[model samples]
Target: MGLILTEDQLILRDMAKSFFDEKSPVERMRALRDSRDAVGFSRDLWKEMGELGWIGILFPESVGGADMGYGELGVVLGECGRVLAPEPFMSTVLLGGNAILLGGNEPLQKELLPDVCSGNRILSLAFQERGRFAPYAIETKAKRDGDHYTITGRKSFVLDGHVADQIVVAARTAGSSGEREGLSLFVVEADAPGLTIHRDDLVDGRNGAHLVLENVAVDGARVLGTVDAGADVLDAVFNRATVGLCAEMVGSFEEAFERTLEYLKTREQFGVKIGTFQALRHRIANLFAEMEFTRSIVRDAQTAIDEGRNDIAEATSAAKARCSEVAPLIAGEAVQMHGGIGMTDEEEIGLFFKRLKAAELSLGDAIFHRNRFAHLRGY
Candidate 1:
């Protein structure tokens, strides 16, 4: 399929690029990292983005959104990744906001989505347990009581969990661990009783947390979608989020490649530009080819989602797996080509390398997605 953007999409992409370039640059990320910001991002900037209608890119028109598709949102996210801008757009907007949209009832949507669009609320997903990426490998249990449920389990690597206003949690409502049946999703307040959040600083200048729920009580109204039929909702959310992540990886890869190429042209070796060397040129060529391939896959995945294709899951897994494999390759080649300076914190390339490493492991690594792809095909 052709991956060309429409006029409006092109405008949106340019607007996002300019906005990030002016508002949240690499220096902003460095400052956030050094200060160990409690929120791990700039709320002021987030609000400004909300005011600019970026936070509502995927929501429907009734909810104060621009009524755009995932492709438009992908364009914006790709630009955000180019600068390594530190914000919770992925966690808050893509993962959290999408969870509600996909699973929440009409009343819940009416209550929450406007705040989400206006940046008055932050949301996150707490799904993984024991480092497992399988959607069905949930051990978190939510025991039902009279019009309520008591959640008891631990969630690890919850994105933006430390500062989110709400978190969408996955728990086993009726099935055994690793079973696809009887899974459910619930939105719990971040500061709810019996909940403890422990924040950890990540190498990529972001923050995540481990959440422990000790008899945490949630009202029946907090349940998202049907009581014990949330597997499809969770699956839809994950697949979309994975595709979104792949879009961000595409941006990172493109920027890293661009920076490495610029370095090659300017950096001197043996009284000549390193880019002139045949060996390094071939490596650059190969990196460029891999980037193009990853870009195509990402676009295909996003387009599949926008078109509501039946094969979206397989396409998303393929895109994410391809991006996972190529991100590290591009980062490694960029670092090696840049020589000793690339290893230092003072160099910008190192930041890209760290971000790529984080992305490679975030949703599912290349190996994980490869296995998932095979499984999806009944291999």
Candidate 2:
């Protein structure tokens, strides 16, 4: 089935596809694998994206964004995923940038968002700990002091952490008995005195970091939302992130599927092309059906969120869960059908496989999303 994209969204996807095709080729990504820090895209390309105003596709036009909804953002994210652009779109654009729009103070938005929109500033989320999948399981503390808050604890798996100019952090200020109560999110400067950043490369070849806050102090102006009332806003940020991630994963799977199909059309076994084999063709058709179903799931989820529907949790969980399962399955079959050649890094198909595996666990993964789906269904 065809996608339900408007001409504007199609234009956004086309723009992103052109940028990714030019700037983030697989060879470019492989070159950055050995680098100690980030696997980001070209600076000039990033500036071009900024000039296009795509960095703020979902933000209000008043705030330097294009004011497009997730429909367009999802399409763009899909294009980003196709090439595995390492420019921290989800971390900066979808998560850190979104928090400002959802709950940041007017001054904070004015001070930070303009630079972010221009791609001059890199930002990311410092929201999880050892247990990233649990949103309310934070042990990080940000206690109010005289004119600031002192944070003490660790946040792990921060996307684009070491390279970020700013980090949006989530910390707990109250007891677990009242989980959501007394929790808060804050915007911490990357170079804040008491902060230490340790970078780790994720399975996807992206630079992720674990931030250690040894009594890192933040001024009163750094608080993101009302003190002890950040849970809802954080939920919104993740919801947006989830929807965007679904798009990315879908793109990855889409490319992998197409690549595999092309391979089947070319590879000969027993003097015949594999695509002519009835058994393999049936399998490929089955994968396509499942993938198209997932496409519908992601589309409906994006539409629900874009329309401010109350069933966002349910829709997002369904989309993420479907993606988590289907992407890996499709990628694995793509590799299997390609045989030994798919295992080599020299082959572009292998790169897509690696990226697909990485996307499998991003944000929440299949199991987590499945459980969330159950919870939303009142199980």
* Candidate 2 lDDT, 211-295, residue by residue in tens: 9999999887888878888888898888889899899889888988998999999999899999999999999999999999999
lDDT of each: 0.89, 0.84
Question: Which pairs clash in the backbone of model 1?
Answer: none
Q: Considering every candidate listed, which one attains the maximal TM-score?
A: 1
Q: Which ten residues in a row have the lowest lDDT in candidate 1?
A: 130-139
Stretches of candidate 2 above 4 Å error?
1-3, 34-39
Cα lDDT for residue 241, model 1?
91
Clashing pairs counted in every model: 0, 0
lDDT of 1 at 36: 88
By TM-score, how accurate is candidate 2? Answer: 0.95
lDDT of 1: 0.89
